[model samples]
Target: MAQKKARKAESSSQRGKAQKKKAAGQAARAATRSEEVSGIQAFIKYLKEVRVEFEKITWATKKETIGVTVAVLAITFFFAAYLGLVDFSLTKILGLLY
Candidate 1:
């Protein structure tokens, strides 16, 4: 049983190494293929890919955008008031010390 477990682990490790080498070879081939493409062709390919990726994006609706904007404004107002209060208190304390 112990030997079986050890053999299993060894085989899995070897398989992992083989997979890594296979992936590396595929990447090398892809790089060579890309290198063979003309510059303008590569640019057009890049633009096409960008457009495809943009098509996959899920944009926020107007309602969602307005809600986020309102939330941000409220948080900003609260923080500004809090910081102003702290600054006033510190200034009063320092004035008394002087």
Candidate 2:
């Protein structure tokens, strides 16, 4: 009874391996037969798809865009001024040490 069960398991394992090999061979053949698109053509198609998708999106108005841009610029200028002050102070201290 044990030998019978062992034989059954061995047979199933062999069948599984055979099925897997058949699938792998079929996949390799299909891949070799598949037509490949060029990178530029694929990129252009992707961009067109994205543009259409963006058209579906509701974006902020020009006024909102301008407001956000101005706020970002103000924050940028403030950070730049702060960094410049720190840099100047450090440079002055280093100069005194020299």
Candidate 3:
């Protein structure tokens, strides 16, 4: 009878330890979730501030904007043409090999 009581006490102790471990895990998860939420909120706030600053910025005039756009387009076309020529040369070389 005493041995049976001792076994029951041992089982209860193990159950207590498991419960403690589970509670600790839950607390750790909550802490991590809160930290993640705070980090995301901070990032969002930073983006909002950046947007506001951009709105206050003195943007380029329409003439300047058009000029910049045209320049970029021209540069893009030049690079595309350059790469296409390179690719064509390589293709020809490989074709001769086969």
Best by TM-score: 1
> Candidate 1: where is the Cα deviation over 4 Å?
1-35
Candidate 2: segments with Cα more than 4 A from true spot: 1-12, 24-52
* lDDT, candidate 2, 1-98, per-residue tens: 99999999999999999999999999998997676678998899999999999899988999999999999999999999999999999999999999
Compose the digit string of candidate 1's lDDT tens values, residues 1-98: 99999999999999999999999999999999877978898899999999999999999999999999999999999999999999999999999999
lDDT at 63, model 1: 100
Instruction: For model 1, state the Cα shift of residue 16 in Å.
Output: 25
Clashing pairs in 3: none
TM-score of 3: 0.45
| Residue-pair clashes, model 1 | 0
List lDDT for all candidates, in order.
0.98, 0.96, 0.96
What are the models' TM-scores?
Answer: 0.65, 0.57, 0.45
